[model samples]
Target: MVDWLTVLASGLLSFIVSIASFEVRLRREQSVEESAEVEDWYTETAAHAAEVRRTWQRLWDSPEHPGSNLTEISSQMGLFERQISRHASSGEQLDVDPDVVDALDALAEECRKPSEHSFHSNSNSEFVEFRNDILDAVERVEEHLAEN
Candidate 1:
């Protein structure tokens, strides 16, 4: 009373199910890896922004003895900005806003060519404003990424 066609169909269905499950698991793992990479990039970028702010603070604190690290940090910031731009424009799952990326890029450019007045002044209000703007932009980017 056993039907050979029924047995063959059952076997085929089981194989299909197994392949689908594997595919779902593989996609999930890839998503997690991509998310982790995005997080790492954001962390590194934020750290660089913080360092740039700290360097400006140090310069303001000791206007007569400015360190030579500003150019180096600024260059690093520019690199990060470019990487972020690439990710944002690559049609990837990165939900970052273009405006936020532009803001960060502007900050990087500002850091690269700091105002002489801001550098020599002990108050450094301009630098403070720039730091706050950069932090805000970074926070916005983080928020967007969190939604993914």
Candidate 2:
């Protein structure tokens, strides 16, 4: 009464379905992990930018000579650059937007301006304008990241 061929075919079908389900679940988990990594990277980058801004402000506010903190600011900027580069090159495969890169580049240039004699010696109105430009550039980066 037992049909051997039918039993074998049914067993094969069950095994294939189980394998396919396992693969789908594995891919889904990998996707979630990648997404979380990207989110963390963005959050850290934004915070790093804010920290740079704060340190720059502190340098400007220092009672000591304006150039006193120049070395520290430069170091911080360099570290920030390295952090961005690391994420981009990491095997984790982050999807970086060109617009965000442009925005960050603009911000870095603005950051350097604060240490320049031209910007440092400028009138208060000019200083305010330059500061606003830096803020705008940072906002652009944040907006791009959120959109992506």
Candidate 3:
């Protein structure tokens, strides 16, 4: 006589084991994908930071800045602000260091201030602070990328 109950129970146990195995594989694949995404984000964020720093340096170095309505400079600032903001927000979601995120915010805010014309001259104390802050933020981001 066939032991139907015993066969059914064995089949059920096998099915459960297969399900668990598939779940483990799926989780591992998800983890790998997440890690790759994080790495890509870091690389992109670092590149953006470097670009912002370069653009800001050009703005500060330009002697004709802040006096005339140079559309090109304004456009560059707008792009830099957008990039910084995007990276800053993404970094927050990725649980990047608070200090780094804060620096990013500060840089974006400073870049936005040209619209207000708050600091008319780069020779002023505020200009120095702003310049230093931008450089510092870029350095921090670059260092982080180097370490990873």
Q: Point to the candidate with the largest TM-score.
A: 3
Query: What's model 1's lDDT at 12?
Result: 100
Q: What is the C-alpha lDDT profile of model 2 across 1-148, one tens digit per residue?
A: 9999999999999999999999999999999988887777677668756776676577645677654554455556556555545543452357656666666666767655544524344345555565577667777777877787
Question: How should the candidates be ordered by TM-score, best one leading?
Answer: 3, 2, 1
Clashes of each: 0, 0, 0
Q: What would you estimate as the lDDT of candidate 3?
A: 0.69
| TM of each candidate vs. truth | 0.57, 0.68, 0.73
Please list the residue runs of candidate 2 whose C-alpha ends up more than 4 Å from where it truly belongs after superposition: 63-67, 88-92, 105-136, 146-148
Clashes in model 2: which pairs?
none
Prediction 2 global C-alpha lDDT: 0.65
- Residue 120 lDDT (model 2): 46
Clash pairs for candidate 3: none
- List, residue by residue over 1-148, the lDDT tens digit for candidate 3: 9999999999999999999999999999988887887777777777777786776666666677642333444566667777788878887877456666676776677666543444355535555565576677677767656665
Best by lDDT: 3
Error of 2 at 147 (Å): 3.7
